[model samples]
Target: MSEHSIEDVTRVVDGVLRSRRSLRAYRPDAVPRAVLEDILDVASSAPSNSNTQPWRVHALAGAPKQALGAALLAAFRENTLPPSPHFPHPLPEEYAQRQRDFGAVYYRTLGIDVADMPARLRQTEKNFGFFGAPVGLIFTIDRRLAPHSWLDLGLLVQNVMIAASARGLGTCPQVSFARFHPVIAQHLAFTEHELTVCGMSLGYPEHDEPVNRMAMPRRGVREFACFDQFE
Candidate 1:
């Protein structure tokens, strides 16, 4: 057996990042339970502060998954959802601009013009249905945990996504689902102590869907990264 070179590892990492996207549509096929467990096992290996692994995940599939998605959509339709104040109110101009750009690109990929508000709204609502993915995962953390733990949980989620990618599986980490946390908690029977952090839709991507062809654009490292010790 030959040892992998640094260049080989770098190429693999680049491919993973470039290929991974927020899969909007998935095939109806089911992901095996054992494969799901292996993905979670890889996620668990993510590093955390003081070795405090604060991530909790609820993976659902088949009937139960469909039930949860339907329940959340119902809550959304009934206007009975609670507020999610996780991020700061009134985002900075730069951050807001980037978000707006992402929305524009996303809608365009679906062939939805900016003037078509109803179409955009309908597309956004598809998120509640997990884009018809066969598996849905809800990530949570204790309310008592600090903000850093949420960051740690993010790392874990990234690990899960990357690991899934290596296996030819696709995933979409969804913050939209967090908006219906109350409904999700009730459906999942989560205790008051646990707060929903994020949700992920996982399965095989629908290769034929035009919407799935949208690859989000990213800024170069120099645009976001900075050097230390400014003069």
Candidate 2:
């Protein structure tokens, strides 16, 4: 059914995934509507739990995206909202270490000393700005669904990022937006039945930014995977 050999597909797919990084800065140029749509169309092929397709995406750009970002920034500065818990409390040491490692690498790349709270705060604020990306996407799921459905949503999100990456676009998936769910729900006016999942930034990358070059190390397959039946 396909013209390309299996090796061709494997090479291309591997290249795309390896090259994709969570870009924190982007050029101001706007992404065309059709291109955005096409990327999403490709992402629609991601597998869902029993085809539940529990993902709802809100793609924002231009004035609307800016307006939402402004509202989020204001709320962030005021520090009035309740914290949205992302990680488990008293998170196990191993996973926590990985998170710390990520932060160290990320900040080090930008030449920001980890102890510089002010600088870190400012950089954190940029998340609300979608890291200067032109298109900001908000993903949501129905509150009633179980964790399996959320996993399905993540599959969709991964597909979106990979699809965008294949097209020379950059993306960042930010869970910080989940903390301002009320503001987003009011601003975007989505149904209350839905729960905020996460937000993402998508746009043409600004290649000159040093943060764009930061690459976190990943554990080797032998370190993270388990196999028994294979010989």
Best by TM-score: 2
lDDT of 1 by residue, 87-153 (tens): 5678888888888898888888788997898888788778788888888999999989888889999
- TM-scores for all predictions: 0.93, 0.97
The list of candidate 1 runs beyond 4 A from truth reads 228-231
| Pairs of residues clashing in candidate 2 | none
**Could you list the CA RMSD of all candidates, in the order they appear?**
1.8, 1.2
Report the alpha-carbon TM-score of model 2 versus the true structure: 0.97
In the predicted model 1, the residue pairs found to clash are none
lDDT (Cα, tens digit) per residue for candidate 2, span 1-231: 299999999999999999999999999999999999999999989898889888899999999998999999999999999888898877799999999898899889988899999999999999999999999999999999998898999999999999999999999999999999999999999896888999999999987888998877889998978787679
Q: C-alpha displacement of 211 in model 2, angstroms?
A: 0.5
